[model samples]
Target chain A: MTEFDREQHDHFLRLFMGLEESLRVFVRSLLFTHDEEREVMQEVAVVLWRKFDASMDGEAFCRWAFGVARMEALAFRRDRARDRHTFGDEVFELLSQTVLEHSDSLEAERHALDTCLQKLPEDQRQLVQTAYAPGVKIDHLAAQLGRTAMALYKTLHRIRLTLMDCTRRVLATEELT
Target chain B: MNTKDPRFEIIRRSRDGNASSEELARLEAGLREDTDFREAYVRYMNLDVALSAVAKAAPLPLPTAPPQRPRWITWRPLTAAAAGIVFGMLCTSVVFGFVAQRTAVKKMPLSVFDAGLEDAKQILNDGLPSQEGQWGIDHAKVVSADGKVTPLTGLHMLRLEPIPREKRVKNHTSRAYQVLDLRSLSASAMTDNAEAEVSASFCAANSGTSSRYLIRAIALDEAPAKATKNFWSKVESDGVVSESQRFDTAPGSAGWQTFSMTLRLPPGSKTLVLIFGAVPPEDGPQPASVHYLDEVQVSLLSSETPLP
Candidate 1:
């Protein structure tokens, strides 16, 4: 590869790596199903790389990237519009706006979530990880645990709420310093 | 935290894509109207995303084995089938009951103007009566702005001009306004001290023009035919009003900006009017300008505490 091409490739990777987590969060907020979210995120990454120009500054990258992600999400929704219980377009708009507005706080919360996950008791953490593992179905997990699906969902919900509360407290305390 | 908070149930159902039509509508309205609910929904969704990310980064563990069945299961097929049928029936009933409850709570809000300026005009001319009373618009034309003839998503948008061309040349200044009667829409759900949220997307033809778009929720003791006669004074006299920040696009900018504001409905108010208008620039070359508006919505923000 030419030196210029190599430099461009490296810069693209750096920006992708820096914003990967936020991009994933943003895409997932618009999409509920994991597979679709992953598909859209991959498409967004490719688009961002192909369009990476020097005019785009680091500070504006997230906003620009999110705009691309939003378009991808809208397309995905159109493709899946016939699916049962799909979110309305207004919901997607609201979510996109909210994520962009809270991107900074969300990044902090993401970090705090990592810390919070590590602090989870071993069994609870294992349950959460296993439940979210790439192809694991919640129904199958519930059957394995000898619990009803509703019970399992409630348990997972509690864990999520706990993490949310913990992250909020951590961010609040951080703001005090 | 209440483990049985209905909001959590709604969020969970929404995340799982099992939320019925009514539940979905309720969730959307809540997100638009309540700050705390919106924040909670965003945080929960973010945490779910974060958890999934963490799971993907970590190595997967071996799957757990299913519980063992008794060896005599072969001989008890008939008995098991009978029991299974009974269990299936019970499960079906429970599922149906849940769905019924969800749909039962569905309250369709009175839609004043959802889309198509022609339909809005027809309704205005026909004087459609809503729960609160009759509804009409002052002066609105469906016009394309900045070459965006089509809406961001819909087919048309209402362009409210601040000053008509003929009137602008005559007086060199005039306030053109469009008011949509929202009393029927708001009165159906809002009580005294109830909070409602109004949301819309707006854009200006030229950023340099003194053109400005303002969305206001005014509580009136009675419906007014036109918005021009001391509306602000009446709003002051009536004492319950909420207005969004005046929105103006930057020069050369070409995109729709979303604006949302929450308002408290006052007691004894018979009508709620949503006013959208452009204020003509005093000294700009383009004294008359049209402000494009679309996707106007109003939803009540419930303040009820979730049941334990």
Candidate 2:
């Protein structure tokens, strides 16, 4: 490989891969569906890498990366202007800005989820994992388990709330100690 | 964490695709006005992303050992694997292959638009009291599944509510026109005996009067934009075929039923416009009556050569 190309790949891969999860969560928070998140994340990665510089440090790079993510996600939302579920441009701007402000706390909550997930009952944790498995459709899973789709959805929602409660407790306890 | 909170319902339904437009509006408002709601929203979404990442990294939950939250799924593993000089050349190709595949990523599913309405907004639905987004509608208000109903598959379904009496015209059935491009198929699939099979799931309130689930399929040699002009004018003579199922939904009736119709493509047809319609009985529409549409699909069938 050419020295110029090798340097670009090395520099881009290190920073980009390291921040991949943050960028994903950032973009996903701004969009409605997982597919939309995947789409916007790709666009964000391309824009970040294409304009990436070796001189930029972690903080500057993160700011720039998040800015790109915000724009791309908004653009994606605008394309679906007909969709009723999507946030309007004003609401989207407000939410994205809020997410940026709370990025650090959100990241902490994200870490807490790892521990909270383990605290769940074995069956519930198994179900949550199965639900989020790659390309796992709830309907198909429901049929396999002899449960109706609505029943399955209700169960999943309850599990998520439990996880949320667990994470909040974990974070609060951490604050105390 | 309060399931009883309206905010929880709104947020959960919005994520699950069950929230109506009104509920979504409330969610948007809460996200803007309430700081607590905003924190909850951020936390929920953060948890969602983290769970998905963990689930993706370890598809099977480890009952015995805790699965680590994967920071970057493949990077560390690949670097460790690359430490061996014996497989230097092989490792380089594999790493480049993975990077190239990731860097060159395109957007989602192969279809140009999401047919399932689960992802992209290619399919136009529910413009207002008398319109279906870009497509004009009949005596129907394309509405979202509300407290009384839910979507057949995804979080959203087209609920064909009655149009206002003053705005309603006589003999106008409640339906939406779906214009599908015939150019999407292979040349071999567009034969003299080629047929376009149209199918969609329909549902009604169980305590409703009898209603006719209707479908009218037509093939045109003109473009989609031009086909609509001559659409209602054409009948079931050559390229068009219509089929329907009339039923009286009882207390324990089937919720959503799939209906289909097939239209033989007139040779050299360029487009297909399907009318997914609903016909009420001679009696006026009932308060509990509903005509819902979801999971619409169009596929090719042939007498000689199979659909490629």
Candidate 3:
């Protein structure tokens, strides 16, 4: 208890909790799936807290944590290379830097995606939810829906397309509001 | 979204994990070459991750055949992500289980307080006080707003009445209480500086009268059920430490206004009862105008930390 002040620990929790989701999203973008990010995120969180400075502001913490997540994920990816297909490190660097630059727009897009998801046809929304649910296998989902795996992937792709369009339109008009 | 755009297809396939080695190479080339394509890549990746989170947090009934956990157990992304900070890296599994178990109701914090009135009921006077994570109204009622009465936050708010159904007497004040079990707190978790920082938003549903609200929180050495038997009048008998905060709304208080108070938790505090009261001035009419309370919160805090 003496190593860290109780107030500083609480402050760390507040800042960490506030930014957890963004950090999760950042880590997830680097990894393959939800479960993979789960492992890396744990390490990233530990490192972040172990090195957290009482003086760092939220923005500084975010940038630093995202950097930690990027490093941890890339390192994890190196060991996980044999199991799955991964984009080149060059692509990862590009996307990571781009997301940081467009953080505001990405945040807007995050909220807009929520709105756009609600705008979908009910069945499509359900399909999207069921398809992306943690641990749901695409083949099983396709079979459950009585469609071929390829057809189901096409349907999901179309739904994402619709959602992306809606989100773009929302962001475009967000300035007017 | 333009189906004809090859870069868009590559981005979508990559997100869906349907891209081949050649397709991934093309995607990497596209990202390195086109600025807009790179933007699209980040957006798609963000969307992909968000969709997975949304799917996990989606309502309990998912249509797929995936192995599903029980409905009550919700996987809060942040909780899992923050578990490591509570314990060391090796203890994260333990901390995560503790937190994940603590949240029986999804989207609700792992605390004894329910700020949003979602789990509360309208049972009035002599009705059992709220259990942990609920509000037990003595004379008032927790009600859903249909249109005539509006809640400050969620669909429901705590409504304070001037008279009690059980007591039918001249009482303009209403009381609601919630209890917290502190046995789960590891002895070393919080220092003596641990405080319960409570906050709630209040609004006057009527016109032309100031309404006051107060919170009485006491830390006891016994269980809440035992403490509630005396309704905290015996706190003095037990020599327990208690704190109270009172605020009065101005005439025509207008929009929802929020207030906060902090109560320090003394050592050996096994149970905590958070008492909420809406008191009309003693000299005012016996049955004052109706007032609404919402967004009630009770958070454990370090001594100096303030509730927002």
Say which candidate scores most in DockQ: 2
Q: Can you write out model 3's per-residue Cα lDDT over B1-308, one digit (the tens) per residue? A: 25356677776676667888888778778877888877776777667766765665443363244233312122111101101011112111111100111111111112434455654553443533534545677667777883456875457777777664345555546777777777665554444445555666667766467778876777766766675676646666534667777887777667676666656566566777777777766653544667777766554542211122
Which structure among the candidates has the greatest TM-score? 3
Model 1: runs farther than 4 Å from truth?
A85-90, B1-5, B60-308
Interface RMSD of each: 16.4, 10.6, 6.9
Give the clashing residue pairs of candidate 1, or none: B162-B176
Q: Which ten residues in a row have the lowest lDDT in candidate 2 chain A?
A: A1-10
- Model 3: CA > 4 A from native: A1-5, A83-90, B1-4, B60-308
Record all residue pairs in model 2 with backbone atoms less than 3 Å apart, i.e. clashing. B17-B155
Q: Measured against the native two-chain assembly using Cα atoms, what DockQ does each of the candidate structures obtain, in the order listed?
A: 0.14, 0.21, 0.16
Note the B-chain TM-score for every model.
0.49, 0.51, 0.57
Model 1 interface DockQ: 0.14
What TM-score does the predicted chain A of each candidate obtain versus native chain A? 0.86, 0.82, 0.83
Model 2 ranges off by over 4 Å: B1-4, B61-308
Docking level for model 2: incorrect
What TM-score does candidate 1 reach?
Answer: 0.46
lDDT string for model 3 (A79-149, tens) is 76666666566776777677778777876776677678768888888787778765688899889878998
Query: Which 10 consecutive positions of candidate 3 chain B have the poorest summed lDDT?
Result: B76-85
